[model samples]
Target: MTTQPDHGQELIPRPERTPEAVRVALARVAPHRISDMERHKEQALTAAIADGKIGHLRHWLTYWQAQVEIERRPDLSARYRAALTAVHGTSSNDDPAFRSAMNELAAVEAEAQRAVSA
Candidate 1:
């Protein structure tokens, strides 16, 4: 039988090597919105996969992993609040200041699809 390592030992802490966008986004979206965020994430991942953006896939995976880890923590919801405060505009769906931001992002995403096809 093998003994487990010490609790203090570092064996690859979560959110390891994830992009700031993903890490921060996971932290920013509301706890209730996490499921929605995850859905959007899956869409992005599917798009990235279809487009052969392997790098983006890795980032998505890292983001998903971090999200799972975060959700497990008791303070995960608070972390999301802090993230929202830090990256105010990226959350196109929730902000009142940027009324059209969500629409604009949707348009941009659509354009990206068209561009990929073209």
Candidate 2:
């Protein structure tokens, strides 16, 4: 039987291979968003496939697991947080920071897309 490589182990060195922007994006995927998609994976996949996109079960597993390594690294987390705060402004102490940050990041990413295609 051919054994599969443990991708989690293989991915440990991946962040260094990417540019800072990519590293920040990976580290900063909001866990709550991941959870929401996971909760509705069946429907999301069906809709995505209907729209001819490549979404599938476990499509996010690799990236989500990669988050662990990203978050564990102090350098990556610091960069991620900085990038997020820059795009999103600041949240108060009692606010839900991750959600706020993700919303801001999404807006920033969308604006970038618009500018690029304009």
TM-score of every candidate relative to the true structure = 0.33, 0.35
Q: Give model 1's TM-score versus the native structure.
A: 0.33
Mark the regions of model 2 whose C-alpha exceeds 4 Å error after superposition: 1-34, 40-55, 90-118
Clashing pairs in 2: none
Worst 10 residues of 1 by lDDT: 1-10
lDDT of 1 by residue, 1-118 (tens): 1132232332223333345444444454334655665676688778887998876666565545545344433344244445445446555646664445445434434432332223
lDDT of 1: 0.47
Give the Cα lDDT of each candidate: 0.47, 0.46
Mark the regions of model 1 whose C-alpha exceeds 4 Å error after superposition. Answer: 1-38, 82-118
How far out, in Å, is residue 32 in model 2? 6.7
